[model samples]
Target: MPKIVRHGTRVGGDALSIRIVAPPERRASRGSVFVPPLIGGSGMQQVGYFRELNRRGYRLVTFDYRGHGKSGGRFFVRNTIEDARAVLEELRGEFAGEPLFGVADCFGCIPLLCAAAERPEAFRALALFNPIPSLQHVAGPREVLANYFLPRDGSGARRLALRNPFDLRGMLYATNQRLFPGVDKSRDHFGILRYTRARTWLATWEYLSSRPLAGVVSAVPALVCFGRSDRLLGLEDPAAEERYRALWLRHLPRCEVRVLADVDHYWTGTQARASVAAADFFERGGAVANALPGSTLAPRARYRDPGEAPGRKNQLGGWSRSSGLKRASGR
Candidate 1:
């Protein structure tokens, strides 16, 4: 069995719950940090992946997004990035010598990309499953509007006045199941409907749609995998892969882009494959990058502050690795 340790970090006034799982040792020979997708904070969503990675001897760290699962503070797009920086800081202190890898799913890709863009050297490689560059690209305007009721710090009364009555994400899930047989609608899920704050939804839509995909680039090797039949991103069409290939090539030309035939947007039964792909990418190193024919590794560059981009500096609160965090729990 793997040893589990829990940590809490006060980030921008919010307390984040993070879990670190490692083989029975102080440290592992290799490790990677897992950034949960939107609605991905619960350990229930990630424990399987953790166990699978553990079998490969990789230490794993996963955290609950604020307002989701047991973490404190309201969830929002900017907060996601802030929380991610805090997690990375903690990872540095706990697992120093080994190369760190980053793995994320769906909307989690936004913050992962933002964090990686801001600190390219922080991760040795990155793998994004069913990545969404912008929610606006996938969701309808009505759904986007449903998330813009009140300000981040609005009074409860004010927030209630503007609250959305419709379960937009739930409707999306229903529609997805109808469109694709692969979506496992049978299993119950604690989806975004329960923890999604209006401010968080609005902020995510804005951040994702506004940010340039090129800025999400990294000097390290990158792998982007999505289901060929993903209804959310419309990758089912044969032309979709080529479209994404063209888009990703513009920013990260050397990144390996794979379109899995049987996978779906939710990754319902495909968790094992995703875990294995991540391990292969991190373990094989240059071999994985080399395997993507017709692409040469990009030149390594010093960490450039991605915040220098227009309107990005203050978009997410400043990042700090300062040490005032308390060990909320451990085992």
Candidate 2:
């Protein structure tokens, strides 16, 4: 066990909370900050992961965004990013001059990418799990329902959903369970949904759907892991998977993208397995040269015209390995 400290801090006038876990004295110099998914709180849901990370030689910091459990203000995309930056600033002060790594899962990837782009030198490397490449990736029935349920409009439906968040809660919970049945449900994860306000719908949708990841490219290394069977992000299909792989390669050519076979969006039973991938990536300094023993490199993909679908037949010929990108999977 390690010393765990909790505190409430103000980021851009919004009160946010964080839990800091100190690593063992021998590995105190190494630190990794984990940015959790949309379900925010006192960081209890991911306590298991961060604690394991700490045991693996990394000091850990996890936080809750505004409007989430133990945090003040509304949950908005921009506010969450600011919350993350504030938490990072706090951690940097504690581990001054130490090498830093970032681990973001689900929606956490957005702000992590934004933070990396804003302060390229802040982190030495970043490990992203099931990253939402863009809001468009998650846009669908949920997005539509969220927009229809926006509290700003003061609609009857909005009032109902807020009055009984369980309806929306079940929808989200079932979605997760379907995607990753092996997820540990021992923690009280209902807080993320319970505290969510109707106003968050509009803000979340706007940021997720419109925010462009292309502009955030940097020299900093990123280890991107995607579950091959992810339904939420729909990387299961070969074509869809290739498109996103090409997208990331186009933006961050040096990035190492590993596709975990049979895994889903939430990582479910793959936590320990994924952690190994992250540990290896961090140890290799984000280079593919030292990728997991079975990992291999593929050529970088170039961005095609927006009007042209990725891998669509063209004058150059149909989709092929020579077309710039190929699927690469590893543990």
Candidate 3:
């Protein structure tokens, strides 16, 4: 096993905790950065996928977002973009001539996309797992209930006690979801609550929902993976699946996509399979250059205006005046 070096850096007023797993013998020719999920910790790299990359000759860099782990600061939705950009910029200087790649999961994908939009040349490619394109893409009764009861901040407990008074549905759902078979148990629940704040959670949700992904366009080669069994992403619903593929394709035209069987939002039973696919994709130059042996590109779809409905937000969060591709120049 390669040794991991611990370090800290300041991004704006916040201190970020970062970890780097250097390739054995320092023979690395490529570098990869990991962007953790909303409730993720730096410990996520222990999942073995990152180690696999290290063994395969790719230097691995993973970090806890400000306010999330050993890092010091309050978490906010918008600052995450700056956080990602700062990390990438630092790595670009360190890696120098080597190609740098990005791997993000869940909410992390949002910041990764925004960062890549700003510095398209900084990344050779990107790999996203079960990315949340919009709250509408993952919102459902279960999700609403989960967020209501377990707000990222600890105040959810107090608010639930005062607002609903007697209803324990949120609490019940939060508890039972973890006990479900195949849920990944490695994550630290207590640590996540200690750092997360309710104000930041709400702000993050509002920011993501209000501004659709249409405005952020990057020509960066990308590999997007979805879990067929991911209830949070509503992949069980054909309409939801189609809508997600269409949204991703619009922003990243040079991309390859996959829907893996038996995988869940947390990558439950299929972490190895997902990890292998990502590592292989990265090794093969991270571009779609024709469909890899087993994978197939999603069928092309026509883009349409996101017209509003009478009662609820459209899948793309209704049409925004800023809802269109603003491709990066000189890519």
Question: Tell me, what's the RMSD of every candidate?
Answer: 12.6, 13.1, 12.3
Instruction: Judging by TM-score, tell me the better candidate of 1 and 3.
Output: 3
Q: Candidate 3: lDDT of 257?
A: 77
- Cα lDDT of model 2 by residue, 117-136, tens digit: 77778888888877886655
Q: What is the C-alpha lDDT of each candidate?
A: 0.56, 0.58, 0.57
- Quote each prediction's TM-score: 0.68, 0.70, 0.71
Error of 2 at 78 (Å): 2.0
- How well does model 2 score by local distance difference test? 0.58
lDDT at residue 227 of model 3 (Cα atoms): 62
Native-vs-model 1 lDDT?
0.56
Candidate 3: RMSD to truth: 12.3
Candidate 3 per-residue lDDT, tens place, 169-196, comes to: 3433343243222222222222232323
Candidate 1 ranges with C-alpha deviation above 4 Å: 24-28, 142-214, 291-331
Give the clashing residue pairs of candidate 3, or none. Answer: 153-198
Model 1 clash pairs are: none
**Best-fitting candidate, measured by lDDT?**
2
Clashes of 3: 1
What lDDT tens digits, residue by residue, belong to model 1 across residues 1-331? 5667887677877788887767546545576565553542353245443346667777767776776656777766556777777887887777776678787776677777777777777788888777777655465554434334422233433242344446445444433333333222322222322334325356436544565344666565678887655666765444776786666655555578776665556554456678788878778772445555343222322222222211111111111011111221110
